[model samples]
Target: MGDEQIDAAALQSWLRAFARSVAEHKATLTALDAEIGDADHGANMDRGMTAVVAELDATEPGTTPAALLKKAGMTLVRTVGGASGPLYGTLFLRMAPAAGTADSVDAGTFAKALGAGVEGVVARGKAELEDKTMIDALTPAVEALEAGLAAGDSLQEALRAASAAADAGRDATIPLVARKGRASYLGERSIGHQDPGATSAALLVAAAASTLGVVVGG
Candidate 1:
C-alpha cells in the first residue's frame, strides 16, 4: 500500500469510525467504568470524541495525517480528565510523528507506528499486560499486528487478528486482581470486574479493524 493508496480521507474515516463506535457503546463503557474508575470514562470519552468530530468537520483537515492526529490529541487532552486524558493524549501525540504527512500508512508501517503509540502508553502509565489495565489489551493487539505482518498477511487480516487478540486480552482481565491504577486500590475487589481501560482499549482495536475493513473474529 503506497502513500497514494492510503489518503487523508482514509485517516479521517478511521477517526470517524472510532468516534462512532465509542459513542454507540457509551453506556457499556460507562458500566465497565463503574467497576473501576470514576464511572465517567464512557461519558468523558464520548464528550472528547464529540469535540473531535466537530473539530474535524469545522477544520476539514484533509490529507494531513499528522495535523489531524495532533488535533485529536489536543481535543482529548482538553475534554477528557484524569488518567485517560494524559495517557491517550500521549498516544496520539507519539503517533503523529509516525503518521507524518502521509494520507494513509501501509500494513507494516501502520503496525509499527501503532506499536510506538502503545509503547508511549506503557511508558506514561507504567503498566504492563495482566496488570488489569489497558496494557493487557493493547499489548496483545500490537503483538498480533507484528506477528501478522511477519507472516506476510494483508493489512486487513493483520488488523483482524489484532482485534481478536485485544478482545481475548480484555476477557482475560476479568479474573485478575488489579495491580495498577485506581483499580489497584480495590485489592481483591477488582478480581471480579473487568478493567475499564482494558475494555476501552479493546474497543479501540475493534474500531481500527472495522475502519480498515478487517473481518474480526468473535
Candidate 2:
C-alpha cells in the first residue's frame, strides 16, 4: 500500500496477512476439520504461513513478486502438515510464473496469476466445484474476480466481489458431500458441515482484499 505497487513487499504483506488471519481463526478451522478430517488444517496452515513470513522477511526487499510468491510456496510445502501443504503450495508455485518477472503487476495481471494458481489447486487436488474442498471457495472467487474486471470494475471492486464469492462458496459447502480429502471418507456424513478447506480458502481471499485494497487505491 505504501507505493501502490503489487511488488515483492506487497506479496509479502499478503502472505503475512493470510498468516495472521489463519492464527485468528485457527480454533474455528480446527473445529470444522474435527468433524470430517484429522483436525489439523488450522494448525498446519498457521505453521506454514508462519514459516512463509519468516522466509520472506529474511529475503531482500527488491526481489520480484514471482520470486517472492514461489518462495512462499516452497515454505508452505516444507513446513505445513497434511495434503493441504502440497495443494496450497501448488497454488503459489503455479502463480509465480503467471505473475511474470515484473517488479510489479497490474490488477489484470494479478487476476490472471490468481486464476492460474486456482487451476493449479484444482489439478493437484483433482477436485471440482461441489467437491466440498477448497475448490468450492477458490473457483468461484477467481471467476468472480475475472468477471468483475471484465465488467470494468476497479480492482478494489473486483476484489470485493471475489471475497463475497469466496464467502458464499464457503457457506455453500455446508450442504455438500465432500468428494476429496479425508472428509470424502465420511461420504454422506460429510454433508451439512462447512468444509474447513473452503473456509480457510475464503479467508485467503478476504486477506487479499484487505491487504491489496490500499495498494490498488481502494
Candidate 3:
C-alpha cells in the first residue's frame, strides 16, 4: 500500500500497479476477448503499459500528478495498438486537466477528476448503460464514488464502494449481448461470455482501491 494522498508519486505507483495487474491477467483478458473479439486486448494492453512504465522510468515528471498523468496518456496513445489505446489514453488525458496543478487532491477532487475521466471514455466510446462495454463497470464505479463522497465516507470507504460497484457491473455484463465494439458483431452470441473491457475496467478500479489501502468489500 502507499500514501492516501493523490499525489504524483502515488499516481505513478497506481499506473505501475495497474500495468502489473493487466500483465498478470493478460491471458484471461485475451481469452475473454477471443470469445467475441479480436483476442488482442491482452497483448495490446500489456505492450502499452510496458511502454508506459518505461517512459515513467526514463522521465522525471516533477511532482504534479496532472503532468504525470498527461504524459502517461500520451505514452499509451503512442505505444498501445487498437481502439483500447485511444480510449484509455483519452481517459487519462481528461483526468490530467481535472487534476489541475495540485500536487495532491482531496477525496472530493479525486472523485470529480475520476468522474471526468470516465466521461471522456464515454464520449470517446459512445457507450451507454447495458452496452456491455468498459463503460458498464466505469460508470457504476464513478457513480458509487460520488455517492460515497456525498455521504461523507472516508476516501478508502469511497474507493471500496467504487470497486464493489465496478465488480457488480463487470458481473452484470456476463448476461448482456454486447452492443458496441468487436463483440457487437457476435450479436446474440456475445451473451454467454463476460466482456473483456468491462473485466479489465473492474481490475483497474480494484487496483485503485488496493493501491490506496481501501479494503474492497470490507
lDDT against the true structure, each candidate: 0.81, 0.89, 0.87
All candidates' TM-scores? 0.92, 0.95, 0.94
lDDT of 3 by residue, 1-218 (tens): 22246777777778888999999999999999999999999998999899989988986756588888888899989988688999889989999899889878767778888899999999999999899999999999999988987887777888889999999999999999899999898899998899999988998898888776443464
Model 1 residue pairs with clashes: 6-104
Candidate 2, position 110, lDDT: 91
* Model 1 spans with C-alpha error above 4 angstroms: 1-5, 213-218
Candidate 1: deviation at residue 42, Å? 0.7
Most accurate candidate by lDDT: 2
Q: Runs in model 2 with CA error above 4 Å? A: 1-5, 215-218
| Candidate 3 weakest lDDT stretch, 10 residues | 1-10
lDDT of 2 by residue, 80-100 (tens): 958999999999999999999
Count of steric clashes across candidates, in order: 1, 0, 0
Superposition error at 15 for model 3 (Å):
0.8
